[model samples]
Target: MTDVLVLTERELRAAVSLDLDAVDVVERAFAGLGAGGVVMPPILSMAIEERHAEVDVKTAYVPGLDGFAIKVSPGFFDNPKRGLPSLNGMMIVLSAETGIVQAALLDNGYLTDVRTAAAGAVAARHLAPATVRRAGVLGAGLQAELQIRALALVRTVPEVLVWARDPAKARAYTERMAASLSIPVRVADSPEAVVRGCDVVVTTTPSRTPLIEAGWLHPGLHVTAMGSDAPDKNELAPAVLARADRFVCDRRSQSAVLGELRSAIATGAVPEDWPVDELGEIVAGTKPGRRSADEITVCDLTGTGVQDTAIATHALRVARASGAGHVVEN
Candidate 1:
């Protein structure tokens, strides 16, 4: 018989919040990835164009981990019109040796939010300038708020700029984050303003067209573009890659197909044989990051399955230690 820990969203939240610990867990996973021998497959994505929704399946196996995880994440862009949230999903963990179910983390995308935001923090930690007084975000949704919070853990942020197509959402996000993060969060007049006004910028929107242009990139700027996890979505113009002094991808292979890199490659901005550095390689120190303070660095993160497995494993361990979930025997 095997015992499976079943955790609800609240229980998992009690176990794993979006903190520096979460950032370290994802960072370690990246280190393992950079060291090699980690088996992370391509993302399985299904887009229902009719409803403006997508379902993504991602999974991975790290060499030293006791269990691997498979995560199913769905985003229904129109859900907000229905007065519901857009993102919701869960993860399942299986033992590395026996292939038995270890836990059912019914987090409803909470873990994904944390891990994704943590990846942003990791990007800022290694790539952003030494001092970041102002941070800028392109979206006013969950990820925008979390990314700022995560960046604060790595850098001191006294001010933040946010821009969304919907002015109401941007204003609401500004007010809420200002009160919560104890920092000034203001609504930017435009995407250009957000990019130009801050040293570090994160784009979290679902825009099909480019929200950021190449001309806005400045010296000592760090941009983390995480919104384009699909073939049809893009946030940064292809030339943005050309303008960047240093470009980093979460996974070169995956980014070449599904992330912003693909768009850049298609438009002839970045060569097919450009030879870029993966975030893992930089994290592992096998590759360099931001050689000089004047370099404009960009990180393309499509999100990886190793991160899912890593965070799921970490959350499960914490849940057990804190007695947060119910165990089911099968």
Candidate 2:
């Protein structure tokens, strides 16, 4: 018989969150990526154009970890109209030594949400200016608020600016975030406003076209574009990469085909062979990040399989210690 721990979203939430610890855990995973020898593959993705949905499967095997995770995440943009969440999925963790199932994290995308937000904090920690008075976010989805919260973990965000296609959602975001972050939150009239007035900006929308122009990039501005996991999604103009002093990616090869780098390359703003550094290299201290506060920095985070493996491992450990999940023997 094999025992597999099964954790629901509520149990997983009780075990982990968008905190500094979560950020640190993800940071270490990036470092492992930098150190190399981790077996991570390109994401396997499928599109359901009829339903306006995309499902992604990601996994990575780290050298030191005892287990790895295979996560299945789906995003249905039109679900909210039917009173359902746009995002939902789960992670399956297996033993690295024997390839046996260890845990089934039925998080319904909650773990993805936490780890992605933690990655934003990781990017800001390594790349953003030391002092961030204001942080601007381009989406009013749950991630918009979490990104601001994650940014606050690495840098102080006394003011927050948000812009969303739906004015009602933006208003709701501003109100709710102000109370949650205990900082002043305001709705921006345009994406330009969010980028121009803040030292740090994070684009969390799955925008098809460029929402942020290169002209809006100012000195000391750090932009982390986290929404472009697919070839079709782009948040910043391709030229924005050329305008930045330093361009970083979670993974360069993946970014080249799947993230903002793809858009930049497609438009010829950045060369096909542009020299780049991964966030992992920076975290591992093998490469430099944010050489000067006045330098403009852009990080393209399409998300990574390593992040899923790390977070899933952490959640399972916490659940085991806290006795949070049930186990089924088969």
Candidate 3:
């Protein structure tokens, strides 16, 4: 009988916070998966029912070395009003050679958030300067907090600035996260204020229009745009992308279609000769990061499925060692 590891959201959260080390996991996974190998992550799409306020079933699959992981997520946005989380999802991991179902991770969305935040930190680790000490975070939701935590782990940033459309949430985030992280967290009046004096800026909003503009950035600023995961979503203006000396992304095709590259290319702000680098290339040392202190950098993240696979693998290993999961009989 083949052993299948099952992990819950709570366990996955604990794993990522202490042992999983998302920055390393995401960086290595992208490097290994991007070596002209088998890993492939396609974009995910779904429709919402106006009547039921639920998303219709959608298709998601990522093919890679170990195998493929399929995502199945449901929307329950009103759950928060009822004192519950609004998002929930699962991962179905299959065998590479035998094509048998290996494991089912009932981690809800915790694993995904960890991997996504880790990916942001990985991007910032490569694109941001080593001396960076101030960070600006847009959007005060789960992802924004996670990005701040993960980035702090990878770098020595001692202060963080947060901006949210809602002032109450922003103040609450500053108060809560600052105490937990032992860092000075401040709430900014606007998105521009959040990035104006910061060395690194991370945008986590789901805005259709741009939030961070080009004029607000100074020399040596590193911007990690994490909000634009879909085609219709974009947080950074094309001018902001044009101001960067170097541009990096996780997946080239996806970024071109849905990420900052999409708008940049459409507006002709990023020419054909623009220096576009992949996060995997930087992790593999095929490309350099932060060559100069005055070089402006931007990293557009679309969240790769390979990252999901990597974290899931790590979760299974830890779960098995801790005897934290149950075995379902065949």
Best of the candidates, lDDT:
2
Measured over all alpha carbons after superposition, the RMSD of each candidate to the real structure, in angstroms, is 1.3, 1.2, 2.7
What candidate 2 gets wrong by more than 4 Å, as runs, is: none
The local distance difference test score of each candidate is 0.92, 0.93, 0.78
lDDT of 2 by residue, 1-330 (tens): 999999999999999989998999999999999999889988888999999998999999988988999999998999999999988999999999999999999999999999999999999999999998889999998889899999999888789999999999999998999889888999999999989999999999989999999998899999999988888889989999998999999999999888999989999998999998999999999999899979999999989999999999999999999988899997
Q: Between prediction 1 and prediction 3, which has the larger TM-score? A: 1
- Clash number for every model? 0, 0, 0
Q: Show pairs that collide, candidate 2.
A: none
Off by over 4 Å in 1: 48-52
Writing each residue's lDDT as its tens digit, candidate 1 over 142-209 gives 89999999999999998999999999999999888988998788899999999999999999998899
Candidate numbers sorted by lDDT from highest down: 2, 1, 3
Clashes of 1: 0
lDDT of 1 at 29: 96
